[model samples]
Target: MKLQAVLFDLDGVIMDTAEFHYIAWKRLAEELGIAIDREFNENLKGISRMESLDTILRHGGKADDYSAEEKRDMAERKNSHYVSLLDRLKPADVYPGIRELLLALREAGIPAVVASASKNAPQILRALELSELFRFVVPPDSVPRGKPAPDLFLRGAEEVGAAPEFCIGIEDAQSGITAIKAAGMTAVGIGSEAMLKAVGADVVLPDTRRLSLEFLRGLLSA
Candidate 1:
């Protein structure tokens, strides 16, 4: 039950960049004459940029309208917009207690790693002033597949020099929980308990602000 590392998803788990992502995507969708709302944006969580574009097109019933190259261009445009919004980020943007948890993990010899589907993960971490906290970051391009596929989480565990079974994956999306389980790691979902339980998360908490070394150790031993 020894937990050697904690793999975190950057967006909702580390900082609140979900809205920025949504805004970027929504703006891109508008350019394509497709409307996007927050509910639809939720589906983009834990998915790659291109995959998100695909989802957006599908939701708008226009998946076949754009060629692959056009979709690539659209994804790039969305990313540019997203990056522009990143200038608004500050150290205070980090969720309460997240810094404490990272410090605690480091003090206890446990590495913390970022395993995010965002290609801009490193930049976002820097913007949030959290780039130095992680042992390593596994961004979208680091893995061939995104969430629910296990590759990203597995890479995170490897980067931290831990076996999947000895790692704890903290994520706020169901796809991320699926990926964690598929990687044979312990899943700690940071959202609704019932929803996370339905996806087989080992533990569920309202947020990372609620996590503590004692609580994590208990979960690991349980």
Candidate 2:
């Protein structure tokens, strides 16, 4: 196999926590008396939970005002809110075709691992009951730097006993694509085809729905 493993981004790739994150951030922003709409939440998607907090704080002009204690308190509260909403993420919410894709990877001896910037990656995986499929998980705390830096995916590939060139990184956000490419690996975007392509993903699929192994092969060949 040209690809020895697949490294997936957690938030939007495997777990369907987009709306959950949106609602949590919206509620927190509102409680802080900040203005946050759908667009703001969309921008935060696929980022680490702490990174998401920093984004919201910066957007609200509260980053400068927040003391170290205040930032910690806010991050903790956001985690509380996020954990409360994770009950919505059941096995039923695992992305379309994900089961088959994981099975195929395992059968072919291509280990799959999650490389996310989210501190909540473990919770999400536990909720989906798909934890067993992964060979390793490199969560936010696993790296000193997050996406757009390439540290996360590089570490994930190493942890899975694979080279970056022999691994495919699946992501949706533009920063994620940039990180994957910077890590010396090809990328398969997991969201809208056109937008993903515009970001220069090697393979762009609307979703994981009709995705196949041949599609993955074609991406490697191209």
Candidate 3:
């Protein structure tokens, strides 16, 4: 039961960028004559940029029939909007107790990493000044597929030099949990306990409210 490392999901677990996703995507969707809400934005969580565009376009009633030029045009537009919204990105966006958790894990000699599907993850980590917090940034593009298939998380665990059973994964979406489990790791869900349980998380914490050094150490040690 010796935990060797931790793998974290970016948007929901470490930072609250899901709201930014919703806002930017909603704006883009409207311009394209599609309607979506915050709830609908949830469907795009943990997916790659290309997959995200495809999903949104499909939901709006088009298939992979999009021309290469059209795909690039739409993706660039969305990235432009999404990047601009980050002008307001602040340290406050990081969840409470996350820094504490990282420091504790570091003190315990446990490696930590970001297993994210975002192309913007490196920029976000640098902007937050938390780039050095993780042993490596396992980008989505490196893997053949992203979450729910476990490719990214499995790679992340390798980066941390930990076996799946000795690592704990933190995520906010059902797809994330599925990915972690598929990788043979423990999945800890954040955001909503009930919703995460419904998604089959091994453990669900309401938020970072109760997360602490001792609590995590206790779990990992157990």
> Which predicted model would earn the best lDDT?
1
Per-residue lDDT for 78 in model 3? Answer: 87
Which pairs of residues collide in model 3? Answer: none
Stretches of candidate 1 off by over 4 Å are: none
Per-residue lDDT of candidate 1, residues 1-222 (tens digit): 888888999888988889999999999999999998998888998888988999999999999998899999999999999999999999999988888888898899889998888888888888888887789888678677888899998988887789988888889999999999999988899988998889999989897778877777777798
Q: After superposition, how far is residue 181 of candidate 1 from its true place, in Å?
A: 0.6
Kindly report which residue pairs in candidate 2 clash with one another: none
Candidate 2 weakest lDDT stretch, 10 residues: 210-219
Q: Estimate candidate 3's alpha-carbon lDDT, on a 0 to 1 scale.
A: 0.83
Query: In candidate 2, which residue ranges exceed 4 Å CA deviation?
Result: none
1-222 in candidate 3: lDDT tens per residue?
Answer: 888878889888888888778788888788888889877787898887777788888998976567978988888888888998877777767788887788887777888889988888888887777787778888777889888899998898887688988778899988899898889887888878787888678889888767665775567676
lDDT of all predictions: 0.89, 0.83, 0.83
lDDT of 2 by residue, 1-222 (tens): 488778899877885777877888888888887889987788787667677888898898888877878878877887798789898778988888887888888888888888877777888888899888888889677688888889999998988788888789999888899889989988999887787788779878778886666677677777
